[model samples]
Target: MMVLDGEELDQLYVDPSWQSRGIGNRLVDLAKTQSPTGLALWTFQVNAPAQRFYERHGFVAVEHTDGSRNEEREPDIRYEWRRGPVRP
Candidate 1:
């Protein structure tokens, strides 16, 4: 996982075979710890599983693009996360 511009999360990936195994959870948690104020990242629109994963981790979809800004030129969604209220 890489944090860009001090607050953007990039290149956060786990091998497909390694997915659904909590590695993602750990990485996201670590990202939160490192970027407690806020964090943002983009994922292809076709990656529904990734979108769900980030949503479960408290990220909310805030913007979408027609693949114009990225090199791949694929439709994408942007998600943002902020430190929420304490649970207890």
Candidate 2:
């Protein structure tokens, strides 16, 4: 079991070969069942595919922040799914 949050998700990685094979969707579904407040994650502004995947899973952009890591500033988007019932 993992506790998902903005910072945590920003560091998450999915294998390239397995990127769009519904692995992420299934992982998020598992997370939702274990999470008391549903699933949440963050993706970089340039990561359109991940953003779309999250949106398909009912996550919506809830916030944006300066993703400054090691003194480097980058745009990051935060998404959350707090109210939707997970799809079958």
Candidate 3:
């Protein structure tokens, strides 16, 4: 998934059988590289696993919507990650 000007993450998915195998983390790393300043993504609130995975990767919950705007009408949360200062 690619977003210009660090706007958002369009999509990131791993096959269910490939989950828990670090693929998602690698993809997240790639996204960070692609958007060096930051990246944001929306995920369904019911997806607890996705939330945990994003949190573990340094993403913080920034906002939430109550199923009003989306076509699916499912509550969702927005998470963001900003590049931090480099350490020696």
Candidate 4:
């Protein structure tokens, strides 16, 4: 994963064949331990599963983009996880 001094979680990926075995969750937990203050990330808008996963982990969509800044030109959403309690 690409973390910027424990502030931003730039990327986290698990091979499709190895998914659903808790690897992604572990990685996210590690990121949280490293960056207890908070963490932020972006996922493509078309990726519903990813959005759900992040939401389950306490991340909330905080922003949106029209795909202009990314190489893939895909619309994306930014999610953020704050330090304390998870939102309900």
| lDDT values, one for every candidate | 0.88, 0.70, 0.86, 0.90
**Highest lDDT scorer:** 4
Task: Give the per-residue lDDT digits (tens) of candidate 2, residues 7-81.
Answer: 244344567887767677767766666664655676788889878878988888998887875244678888977
Q: Tens-digit lDDT track for model 1 on 1-88?
A: 4445667898688888998888889988888888889999999999999899899988999999999999999999999998878787
TM-score-superior candidate, 2 or 4: 4
lDDT of 4 by residue, 37-87 (tens): 899998999999999999999999999999999999999999999888658
- Using all chains and alpha carbons, the TM-scores for the candidates as numbered come to 0.89, 0.70, 0.89, 0.88
How badly does each model clash, as a count of residue pairs? Answer: 0, 0, 0, 0
**Candidate 4 to truth, TM:** 0.88
Error of 3 at 23 (Å): 0.8
* Model 1, position 47: C-alpha lDDT score: 96
Model 3 is weakest, by summed lDDT over 10 consecutive residues, at: 1-10
Q: Candidate 2: list runs displaced more than 4 Å.
A: 1-11, 69-72, 84-88
